[model samples]
Target: MTDPMILSGTSSNLDSLRSQLIAGSEKVQLQIIPQLAELGNQGLEVIQEFLWQRREQTPTPVDGKIYQLLYSCGVPEIKDFLQVNFPQGVVPLKSEQGIDYIPLVELLAISDFQAADRLTIQKMCELAGEEALKRKWLYFTEVENFPVTDLQTMNQLWFVYSEGKFGFSVQREIWLGLGKSFESLWTKINWKKGNTWTRYPNEFTWDLTAPRGHLPLSNQLRGVRVIASLFSHPAWDNKK
Candidate 1:
């Protein structure tokens, strides 16, 4: 792990160090990305502060590499920071159900769809709050339901980031088109084949080139109940 102090230096110094760290081989990036994230909120703050300082220097390759590192870190605080600070970067969207939402596109700028997908799920869990973990699925109730706005926000994020290649709305469209058959829906999303669920995090494609409806990731392989919980959510209902 690079010293936290290194990241706390002047913006130029931090930029130089970030360049050196990221410019190293892929193996180095793998090592450093996790270490940076391991620093937790402090590390995320350092990155955020640096990015803000360097905001004037747009379209730099270094920024791309740094954003990739941030997305790969999968820290919810980083996602929150990006969402709050770069509101314009996140595209506003509305679901067919008339839910207004916004997608976080700052991470998508890194072009790592797999990382974006993972981070999106983490962000959803964050938005869903503690009950989501207690319930073991994002269950919606009449009172303390999963916020439709947040769901739509995440869906839009996935849609815009993947160029309409993935999102809940995308999946919902395919689901309805296929008569809401989970089996066919799984196949359409490349999550199943020949009666076996696709292996998690391995067989899954990590690039934008993955099949349509392939994201806004649901951990259906966790069990059919997980899929049931996801599909049965009121957010999927088309009626406003």
Candidate 2:
């Protein structure tokens, strides 16, 4: 059953809610997006209604917020709805590992980088298996837990989506260029400014225009230990 507080909106109420969502501040939008997720199918219906109504209009921040909510809602049906509606916008790529991924460009097109990031990691976890738990803890001690092919696949998706501006491969290149100096790599990736490591979500850039390697994925925000695990992973040595 749909949560009453979530989708209690009549046509009139939804119209008012939509207007408020479009005009709301970032904090307001964040607070509301999660509530919309709680509505399940009803929440999706509201977003789909808005998307179709604005089909002829240029995408806006509100659209991004809506898409973010959709991704966070984690509904396979909602993702399918997006795939069907924006077929051309969502490009599919096959990794050398024989894994396939849908680039989050369709989501990014509406300007929702956070959703894209979340979806990217979600897709990676879906493909990689038990390694996800290891990834969550930034624990790559067991080489088998972190497959190079999966890492490559994740990196490829980010590279394709951001037009080569962000990805593990991009970070690898910078790391190699700096002679594998972790300190230099950190500074270059904006993970560190001078001697201080930058904070997550806030200090990190949530947009495509961010510098190369700024979108550190695989939940590396826990601390330097996570980042170290990622950098030291055997995946980089896989020529494939």
Candidate 3:
């Protein structure tokens, strides 16, 4: 069902794929999106239908997933449809724990990253199990066991809506670029400067002006172990 090269747009196969896109599990939905994109407008029309149902009025996680995939097709109709329908933001949302990522999508889409960063922490905490959920700060052990799907979903929300300017994946890329040096990585992302931590709510840039991989601010004051856990998580390895 993931590959539909032989299936014409009008064929029942496309309908079945559409059904899969709507009702399939997260893994299935992710697989079918690329196949859906290959169908041209027929494919796009179904994508459009899938996304439209999850519009701001209704707001399902599926809308956020499709939103993240919107750039895959540069077709003028798709572009226009997105601009007209989802001016605020877009994506298909799913989570291992049935976590709602629509809030993160809306926050990112509208460029309200201050709130998005807060929600990002909340979402990650939720994924780390009930203790971390209540604590609202993750322990390294919890992070070591984090789900890649949930992390990728969160990273996609940040990456797509921010025009690729942010996300955990972004941070990880910079981390690796600095030879995996935490000090260098922190400095590169403006999280620290000359041994001084970046002051919250004032020094940090909420918009595009910050250094690359800057938003979704992690509490480095808690020290390196948590941020280290995040940068070293399997989630970054599975970002595709």
For lDDT, the strongest prediction is 3
Q: What is the lDDT of residue 14 in candidate 2?
A: 56
Runs of candidate 3 exceeding 4 Å displacement: 1-89, 220-222
Write one digit per residue (lDDT tens) for candidate 3, span 138-186: 8888888878888878887777666567888888888888888888987
Candidate 1 vs candidate 3: which has greater TM-score? 3
Model 2 per-residue lDDT tens digits across residues 175-231:
889997878887887778997777666777888667788774544532456556666
Assess the local accuracy of residue 165 in candidate 3 as a C-alpha lDDT between 0 and 100.
71
Q: Candidate 1: RMSD over Cα atoms? A: 11.6
lDDT of model 3, residue 214:
91
The digit string of per-residue lDDT tens for model 1 on 66-179 reads 455565567787777666765445344433344323334655765667767666655555556666545544443421445666565666566645545677778778887999
Off by over 4 Å in 2: 1-111, 123-135, 142-144, 218-229, 232-240
Ranking by TM-score: 3, 1, 2
Per-residue error for 29 in candidate 1, Å, reads 34
By summed lDDT, the worst window of 10 consecutive residues in model 1 runs over: 94-103
Better by lDDT, candidate 3 or 1 = 3
Scored by lDDT, model 2 comes in at 0.60
Evaluate model 3: give its TM-score: 0.64
